[model samples]
Target chain A: MAEISFQLLLLQLMTGLALGAIYALLAVGLSLIFGMLTVVNFAHGAFFMVGAFLGVYFLGLTGSFWFSLVLTPLAVGAIGLLCERFLVRPLYGRGIDYPLLLTFGLSYVMIESMRVLFGLEGVPTSVPAELKGVVDLGIGSFPTYRLFLIVATAVIIGALWLFIEKTRYGLIIRAGSRDPEIVRILGVDIARVWLIVFGIGTAIAGLSGLLAAPTRAVNAEMGIPVLAESFVVTVVGGMGSLPGAVVAGLLVGVVFSMTSLFAPEYAELSIFVLMAVVLLVRPQGLFGKAGLMG
Target chain B: MSNAILSVRDLNAWYDRSHVVQGISFDVNAGEVVTLMGRNGAGKTSTLRSIMGMLDKRAGSVVFNGQEILATPAFSRFHAGLAFVPEDRRIVPGLTVRENLQLGLIASRARDTTDAMIDEIAQTFPRLKERLSQEGTSLSGGEQQMLAIARAMMAKPRMILMDEPSEGVMPVLVDEMFELFARMKRNGVTILLVEQNVERALSITDRAYILDQGRIVHQGTAAELLADDEIQSKYCAV
Candidate 1:
């Protein structure tokens, strides 16, 4: 029993890291949007679902997985831009209630529209030829695709970090999050900055969806549970801290996976439990700056 | 439009429903250092904010460099050669001192073609040169004030509206700030300064405007305001 449990723990650890990559990608985008516009972005999961759908369709159209991988997120990002300009922009500074409601409504529209078109059946996305195998890691065997997810997520996050820290425009984004008015006074077209940020954020969510579609069943309702989990990660990591999102993502994933190892029935509930514990102790989150949400 | 660097006429400003500045007018001509003197709650800060287009509700005409910019947005005003150094400094968190200065250069009305402005500002503020990599908010109160002014200068603005640059600063730094203002004036940057330090402000500025309860009670040469005891006592509390 002990040997079996140890083997399960190792396997689950690998599973948790890949799951954490997905959560990190989604939560980071959510955090970016929150950081810039202070909008909760309830439609983010819908964007993810749409990206998965777009990925499947694009693969069908071009007969090329690579093209689908590149194009889907761009399409979703454009959709996000439209959402911001038409639906969300008017509600800015009127307090958070209107944006929150608008996004919730948008998420409903996206999911229902997809359901109408694609039905409630789960669509299986074929794994790419390059990633269609398992790797023997001495202790256990892990899917090569899952390892790819972990690596790809890391590369994308590294690029994001470099963009925010090394580039001049990135500086504006960081500074704008702290005090947008000052950024405007400094002469940046803050509206354009926000539009681009919103687009990038939603695009990341879409990318996460596309990446995850191969592992999970692609259905209209696929994003619902993930959305709940992403929110828990966001709140646990702190509202707008990028590093917080990452660490908290991995931590939540590991906890959930570990819980499943022993108490499979309690796996899903473990995330909320961890969130409550973290909030009770450090309300600002591990990396969140104080007074941002309060 | 008037030929002044900045011209304000009958400016009234409010803070979201509460009218703060009522029927005030002022102008800063080319190459002149102008100061607005008033007591606490005298709407001096409101007047500066109105000029910057930072207030939500502001009425009347404000012309900069021969164009009326009352309808222009706050950011466009900066592009139109207006810069405001707010009282609180507003040093952005998570940025180094150098990065903060770089933001000023990026936001300027005209691009710094040579990118020599940063070096020039560093030379002017030697203390800033030493702490270029330090976090902006980690600086001392006086250093942050210096950073604010230097950041404004990085824009190479034709005109700057500075509000209470001396607050929370040590006395020695206050002297350094005044000296820097004098240097800024000598370099042909038009300035409109708001301050509670009546004596220090009057000494550096060419002209002075005294605001009391949202109105300009006195506008004259700095020497004239300094010489007048009653106006000083009534409006400035000096």
Candidate 2:
């Protein structure tokens, strides 16, 4: 039997971080939308799945990984705008559950449509040449793609933080998160902000798909499991807190990694179990505000 | 007088069918200081919210500066020269004082405004000048209130709906806030203040409306309401 050792733990940590990077990206979008628009957007996972396929389709057309990387998200973001404008916009200022149900229905429709075209089997993707090799780690070899994934997550998070903190539009999003009424009173057509936020959220989901496409087999139902996991990440972090999502993503990733080590089959069950534990303890998740729970 | 700057007639509002403001009507004339005064839950805040389109559900006509504005969205109302200073201050807590003011300017038709106006108002609210580089959350309550008003001032609005300018501040700050309002009035910015502080509300306002159960129960000049012991005790007494 392979005894648990420091190197093994280190490997798990690295593995967890890689997984966490993807979860963090996906959850950030969901948290932001909930924060500003109070919409659950159940279709968020479907968008992620759609993005992966988007990469497959775009790469087939352009034969360039980089081109697909940029365009897939933009395409997904545009679709997100249509979703928000047509379905989510009407449900604003109403009970949040409205968007939850509406987006849930949308997710079903989107997934079914993709199924009719792509079939149920997962599609394969190749790692771009630049990211295909393994870099020698002092302890063990690390895939260059995994390193790229880490750096990509960092760069994306940093850019998003800068956009929300330094730019004028960022101020509106932050303000809108707290009190959309005030955002409007300042004379911004908040509807536009909502559209932008929805686009950005879906774009992030798309990016997650593109990032993971080379690592895993993509399929019509691929977004479903990730969707459930991202929701867990978002809720455990906080419904609308970006910081909350990052922390929760890291926590969830590490937990799942460790669980797979102890009991491989239990890895799937670990996420739900942890979510239950969090709700039992903090109730509002880690960074989530208590007063806002109602 | 010049068709009144903002006029509301028989406005009814709801928060998902929970009637909050029922058939309330009041008007703010051009460059006038009007107020809606009542106890908490008496619908003074809701009335202002209804006029600003912040109420979840509201009905009846709201005319602003000769235009029918009842159906207008909140941001559009700002473009038509109306501004609303929320009850909670709603200062962008993470932003610097200047940034918060800049955000307010940018939110509306920013093309017409300039940083020079920010500098000018920053001069008026000296507290804001001192805190210009500080995060909005770092300021004291009074300073936050000043930042809120200074932000609105940057937009150069024709009218502002100020909700409880005196709430949640020090007495000295409250006095200074009223003084600031007086200064704003002299500058010809139309205002509609909503306050539970009847004495202070009456002191600064030309006319006052007493709201109760979402309806207009009393309407008269500020001085007249101040003298009426019965109205003050029954409706607006703290």
Candidate 3:
């Protein structure tokens, strides 16, 4: 019994980390949009969903998963630009709840439209030949695809950190995240900054969808569940704190992975429990700073 | 010196229907540092906001450089050679001093201001050069004020609308601000300075407007306003 429990812990940890990578990416994207535009981005899940759908269709037709990987996010990002130009721009200064609703409504549109085309069914995506097979860790044998996913997430995240902290444009993003009004005074078109951020954020969400498509059964409903999970991780980690999201993602992932050991039924709710505790402990989130936006 | 760069006529503004700026009017001429003087809530701030068209709703005829500019949006107004620095200071806390200054030049893309042009402005505010890499919010009250002025000058606007440059600054720094405004005047940038310090305002401005209860109660050469104790006692005095 003890050996079985230990093995379960190990397997869940591996599984959770992979899912957590996707969640962390989604949370980071959500936070980026919030940091720049002050919008909660309820449409995020829809963007993620779009990435997955595009990944499957494009990869299957072109027989190039990598090509789909590059195109899907950029295409979704363009859609995001249009969304900002039309729906989001008009809603600026109208308060947080308004954009939240607007994105939320937009989410349904994106999902239903995809649903109408694809029908309500789950689609399975196979791993490419290059990433297939097993990677042997000292404890056990893990799929190479899972290992690749983890490494890819790390590299992408590392690149993002550098882009945000090191580059000149990154500095603007960080400044805008901390203070958009100040960003404006320095003569930056606040709208232009917002548009870039919106594009990058939706692109990240798209990437999350593309990355997850192979691992999970793809369906229109896939995005909604991941969206809820990502928000749980975001709230748990700290809203608008990039590092916090990373930590929270890992923590939530581990907890969920561990909880499933005892009961798969309660696995989903474990992160929410952690979220409630985090909220109780730190209302501003782990790294959230107040008045930065106002 | 008396070429009016910016002028407002019968300007009325609102924050969602409550009238804040009640048809007040004034003029700022080229290369002149004119102070908008008032107590708190006297509409001095709104007048400046209206000049930049920052208000959500407003009715007025604003003419900048002889062109009627009442229809211009806040973002477009920068193209018309107007700059606004708000009371909050609005320094991006994480961005270095150089980044803050460069943004003004980058955003405007005006002829006089570029990244290299900002370096020239940096020479004028040596404190900025010393702390070029320092995050803007990290600067002291005086240094941040200097940075704000430097960033504003990146555009080298025909005029600058500065809201309350003296407020929240320490006593020692207050005098330095006066000297900077003086230097700015020498550089040929028309400036509209808002201040609570009546004596300083009178001394710094070429011309002055004393706003009382959302209206201009007095307007004259700075010396004339200083000598009139009745206007001083009623409106300018603490």
Candidate 1 regions with alpha-carbon error over 4 angstroms: A5-7, B108-115
Give DockQ for candidates 1 onward, in order. Answer: 0.78, 0.67, 0.49
Best by DockQ: 1
Query: What's the residue-level lDDT of A45 in candidate 3?
Result: 93
lDDT of 2 by residue, A1-294 (tens): 578988778777777888889999999989988888889989989999999999988998998988998999999999999999998999876898999999999999989988888887857788888789887766577788987888898899999999998787887888777767777888899899999999999999999998988888888888889999999998788788899898899889889988898898999899899999998898898899896821
The numbered model that scores best in lDDT is 1
When 1 and 3 are scored with lDDT, the better candidate is 1
lDDT (Cα, 0-100) at B194 in candidate 1: 89
lDDT of 3 by residue, A4-44 (tens): 76555686688778778888889889888887788999999
Clashing pairs in 3: A186-B103, A186-B104, A187-B107
Model 1 has a clash total of: 0
User: Which should have the higher DockQ, number 1 or number 3?
Assistant: 1
lDDT of candidate 2 at residue A13, scale 0 to 100: 78
Q: Each model's fnat?
A: 0.81, 0.81, 0.49
Reference-based lDDT, residue B221, model 2: 98
lDDT of each: 0.88, 0.86, 0.81
